[model samples]
Target: MTKPTFDLQSHSLHSDGVLAPAEVVANAAAAGVQLLALSDHDTVDGVGEAIAAGARHGVAIVPSTEISAVDGSYEDLHVLGYGIDHRDPALAERLRAARADRELRAERMAQKLNELGFAVDDAPLAARRAAGKPIGRPHLAQAVLIHPDNAERLEREGHDDVSSFIPAYLIPGTPGYLARTHPTVFEAIDWIHEAGGLAIWAHPFWDIDADAEVLGAIDRFAAAGLDGVEVFYPTHDAAQTKLLADRCAALGLLTTGSSDYHGPEHRLFRTFLAHELHGYAPDLSKLEQAAARAAEAAA
Candidate 1:
């Protein structure tokens, strides 16, 4: 099979990604990605900029967003909305609410960190909030890593990378962990549909809670109107990828592929158009049909 040229999941500084929207497009174009989705977490604010950059760089931009949602017994399960109307008022409102919730979670996490003696500076976090950028655990981790008070402790504890802080302190059952109060996965799927987009479960393998029950969760999500699953990902082994692809086929759901690129500075899954996804070509006809329907509905 020919390598897939489209990456359905990515991020920008509009969310947790370090690079700006145009920078992400330029990087994807340089990596020979023909189609790129600027699926920032909980916001499409960067999609317009990314689309313009794509036009300039000869790449197609799929207006998209990665919504952080939950299912029963599954927390922080991301749902990717592709080919969305970036300007949809209802979608914007819902995303705003989600981002607000994220801010609250981040704040609570920071407080917990402080209580645990891992103080986080409030200035940078305040600046991010002031600039309308989403507050994520990464930002908090950066704060923790950079604080003069925590430097010796972090170095002594062998926590040199931002990624190390996440599992150690910010995730569930940790000292700084704070539960998210975001929308349910089903509600997120409905929001994506209302905005004229296809809702796909993003990176099932990354969600530890859902990993063991991938096919079962796919059935549940499909029943709740999920349009697809990200069948090809950098972390998924051949067996896992094939399993997801076969299940998507059996269920008549779209199977998508992506690098889930955050940025080059990221410690893991940093490559755009990763080689792991090159073996499987995603059937984009389904996506095109969905886009056509969306356009017709708009018209």
Candidate 2:
């Protein structure tokens, strides 16, 4: 059988991307992506639309979610879930709770920015969220850029994307920062597994020093039934990818890759378009193997 070629990670308007879930599916079809996943942040609301779009585009749409997991010390540990049951009551309740928490955080962040003399409207943020598109830091960053006093400063500072703009002034401990509560890694992994999905550690090297910390995290995740690790992320170089791949191989963990594409709106544009950088490509064989293993485990 011929191996599948595809991008495993992508976002739609369901989270923060510009395109709708259908549009994302269409774009991936155009990009020659035979297997696609709508790994929307925190919510699985777009999976149904993605499935409909995939049927139309002849692409396999994998049901996926990206959970924000934090350890006891409050470090960010992203866990990717695949083959999950979007309608599973337990999973849905958790996702809904997460969405609510995200809304609360965005509101708090907007209030903090307003108090800091930055122009932002929590109303529209809430309105957009009510319309099913979750509000995120990107909206807040854009609001900051449009502020009269900050506009010139933002442009002068060359903080174009959301990450840079937020990092400069809105991340935790920053001027306009407001910390949001995140789900624990154990909770998220358990939820994913219970929802008939596979849990994967995502982007271990970016912003997260996956040395001793990562090894410790890996141990915990393995005990919790983590099926894979994202070894070939756009954030990783060849050496890093190899190192992760070797680790996964030795540990009997499935390894996978993806562009983590969030369209043009995302601030992380530099790495999001990674496939074009080094002529890289995502291999769906890895994802398939992981999915198979997860299905077997669930069975």
Expressed as tens digits, the lDDT of each residue in 1-299 for candidate 1 is 56778787888998889899999999999999977788999999898788778778877777789999988767799999988888999999999999999898888888899899997888889898999999998899999998898989999989998899889998877788878656999999999999988999998887853555988999999998999998888888888888888899899999887898989978886888773653566678756554444334433
Clashing pairs in 2: none
Alpha-carbon runs more than 4 Å astray in model 2: 1-4, 264-299
lDDT of each: 0.85, 0.73
Per-residue lDDT of 136-246 in model 2, one digit per residue for the tens? 787788777655667776678897557778777776568776665578888888989999888888888875665767666676788778888877676687767666666
User: Best candidate, lDDT-wise?
Assistant: 1
Superposing all C-alpha atoms, what RMSD in Å does each candidate have to the true structure? 2.5, 4.3
Which sections of candidate 1 miss by over 4 Å? 209-212, 288-299
The residue-level lDDT of candidate 1 at 74 comes to 70
